[model samples]
Target chain A: MEKIEVIFYIEALSNEKKLLERAIEATVESLKGEKSIEVKDISVGDILEDEEEELLKYSGVIEARIVGSFRDVALAALRYSPAVVEVLRPGKMEISARELMEILGDVAVFMANLMEKFGGLAIYPKLDDLPEPKIGYSRDEIEAMIVEDRQILYRFVAEVYDKDEETARVNMAKALSYEGCRINKLTVQKAPNDDKKLLLAAEVLSDFETLFQLMAKYVPVALSIIEPEVIDVTAGELQNALTDISGFAQELITRPLKKQLMDRANTTFRLNP
Target chain B: MREALYWEPLEGGKVRCKLCPLNCIISEGKRGSCRVRKNIGGKLYTLNYGKVSAIGADPVEKKPLFHFWPGSCALSISSVGCNMHCRHCQNWEISQADESFPYLHDMTPEMVVAIAKRYGCESIAYTYNEPVIWYEFVLDTAKLARKEGIYNLLITNGYINEEPFRELAPYIDAMNIDIKAFSDEFYMKIARVPSAEPSRRTAVIAKKDFGIHVELTYLIIPTLNDSEEEIRAFARWVVEELGDDTPVHFSRFFPHYQLTHLPPTPLETIEMAYRVAREEGLKFVYIGNVPGHPGENTYCPRCGKPLIVRWGFKITEYNITDDGRCKYCGEMIPIAGKHAKKRYGAEWW
Candidate 1:
């Protein structure tokens, strides 16, 4: 393997000046502890206090010549989130197929785990906690059907515009008997000085068109289909979905590394000039 | 409200609407499947009778009835509501709307005929939405239009039942029916209808039985229906059932309404459909939604010469004799009515 030198520009923020300075010193010392890396130089800037945030932030750059394989350098970037990484020497490096796959697999697993954690936070009030409906199928039953049979369910709250409330009830009764449909609730309300209208909330176990057909039976003057507020996905499906997404994520993760190490081997930037 | 035809009153004020194959059993004060026909006091009433939701003076070719009165202007009108709930409806604003749409304009049959004359349109086109759902209004207007020597054209999905279609067939002079696709699976999945057999059956009856000038349109969606085998089957059906001269249009599908996730139909797919249809031995084949392709023009079936050159909906060149014979090879084109002179680029306003 070719030896490559890289410069990592990193930043650390803390409420106290001592802690901010200590964090940067410890990061450089940790990088030198690795046997495959040689610490060439460490430059630390003065800690500055921000009045807006009420915190002291210190910035530093570490110049290290790494003599390890490609996996070691990539693992370093994943371990420390640097503001920017610049490769200084041995512009281009090549690795075997196994190393490339290992690097991508590590990033994919990390991303999948992070997404799962955040997804768990976003999904709250488990399906069991939802109040049971008085009229139709329970949420748990519907959720189970969605996962098991892969049946898509749609909820439509149709407003039937009519002068008679009895007619709306009769129509709702007929619609409830339609195949693959369940009436959750039906309410008849009249706006002030306006004609009576029926607000019928129903769930249809079919595609968008079947749901529409179920609603059209009422002859609604106008209707709107409401989107489901919460959806729960099984861990198996989430893993499969993330596996498909990882292929695209691999390109996003590797483009910058390839550009810095291979594409711009002879290119140099003068920041002060 | 005008009393709707083709409905039978069941026991207890309920009525079964026989207007279309859907045959929705409607309760009193409720509407049938179309959303415009309501059952009131033991009678089915057509709520959209003479209710015009949209109106335009469009070129007949825009309805894509290329063989029927080639360059004539048609007074196109629509009343809201549709029979089938197609996921990719191009005119969902009107087709998916109810009779309570705020922009509805009330125009009687006489007024529609008068407007057609006022606009110098030779034909009145019941279009934009499915005219089959607006059964009562279209029947009344077409009857009046026929009496006034004006052609009645129905641009529809042809989802109507046989009895209603037969009663209204005499008044209709020409029809451009959208076939959607050939497979029943595509129909069930995308259009949410049980089958597309009704559309094919209607086209055959309109052409063979009634002798009404008929044309077919198939909007080709990417993976939903566009396949060489499917297009060939459609073309073969058209040739066998509606005859070889029934002009078939392969229209390009754009992502619209609920199908916004899909990409627009590629030009290559449209061209492939055109080739496939022609390979099935259909004489008159055209491509729609594409402006200047060679497939947009009408060719002499016998001599293979471009008889009429069109750019979009405008006829740029006409090469037919006074008697409807091709000027190039004297081949008798299966034209329905006399060709109207070019309305655009003329000195007369």
Candidate 2:
């Protein structure tokens, strides 16, 4: 049988006292029937500068370090360690090298399944008051944890927005009313559109109002356009308009009235002659 | 007031929370990552809205915003829940738990403003937890506080999204943000967050874009992130990105919460880190959590004279003029508000 060496990189010896003990115990148990298993505890002082690279070069050396190992049954014993579960979760590990990567991948999966089935079987030796073991999870487990955590975030956001959307829509509607009023006021002056300036202004105002009203109906969509520095107007100006209108459609729809009126006046003058 | 500040409904009965960096895409009857904002029946509501878990009057320096109102007091308040789950969180009781904690005290925005006025505080600090999680409540309080001529302060982790942060920036007068560490790996392993880029970006926006007086705090833990190289890298980044004038507080960390077994950070490490920062051309670097350390004093960057003497949170000697200039050397300091003789004692809080 080929000999394999495993290594574990334990962080904060004091923080992960319990988890480390459990890993050692499990490794010892799995190799009970094996003939060629070995385990060693390397002190922080013993690690040399080139040890990390040298370990990689050695076929049996694990990335972290072996807290414990058993002769002949080394592989089987290591498989029973609780840390294996964490190493097996989805999105956890990213293997850079192809050689022996497939075997490691299989080991990760097997460990994850074992952990899931026999939860809390591994015991962490206590250093002090810190109770939770600082278990170094496999790449997949870490990714899974991230995903799970994100799910909680998703749930929280959904609840808040879902409840407040109506009020937001109403506020948006009220805020946009100024645009329509501005347009209407412009129209009352009967400004000429000969230079096409008034006509262009009216078109711009009309577009603003239309967009604002549409935004009120669907608050998020409109906000997406306005928030990312995409909107042409300043936030203060937008806020002022929204506050004046008291309804989304009225503020937005009324903004272009003045420009539209000026254009109409210009067209009337040109046609009357 | 509504439950949350920035959120919108989406297709298929989903909602998007824009309050913080998580930008949580919440399905029906779900909550955001902070666990404060929730969606019920496709509507959003803030569970911790107006829930004041902690409140007190604290000195401005206690907020550790050394550049803003040096010798004044601010009414500090905090609700619950944070966007990130930092393993070494000092305020885990409030920032990590759900809404079931009994410490919550319900107070409206009007009440908060009134309390600040009653206490004669120069500002109101939204601290002890990530203030972004309590967006609606903070917004309301800020609006009310502004009306009463009271300034608003935020002591935060700076993990907020750009849009919502910009929206709230106008209402905030000053902020003390935790930069944590310079490495993404440290951030991910320690804070349980994927990236530190968002925090860095938020710090920039808070200082330059919003014009808020920004100070930085970094708690140095032994072995994990107290290396000389890491310290130098962090200090350099602060000087390059946040400018030399920015005050960086390198605080000593005591074992707490999940990281209790680790020994307390050595005072020598803190001193070395401070020296590294100064060598990197940082003008204002202070060491915290150690009492009577000389590093607490603010020395004139040009001339090695102690401008402000501090013992813990207390100011023993204040040598800066009302115009924020050194009285002896006449060199101007970058601090805000009027300077005076140390008016408050160390035990003011």
lDDT of 1 by residue, B162-237 (tens): 9999999999999999999989898888887788888888888888889999999999998989988889998898
- List the candidate 2 regions with Cα displacement exceeding 4 Å: A1-273, B340-346
C-alpha lDDT values of all predictions: 0.70, 0.61
Residue-level lDDT tens digits of model 2 in A193-254: 43211111111112222333322232211011211121232323222222222232222333
DockQ of 2: 0.01
Query: What's model 1's lDDT at B55?
Result: 88
TM-score of chain B of 1: 0.97
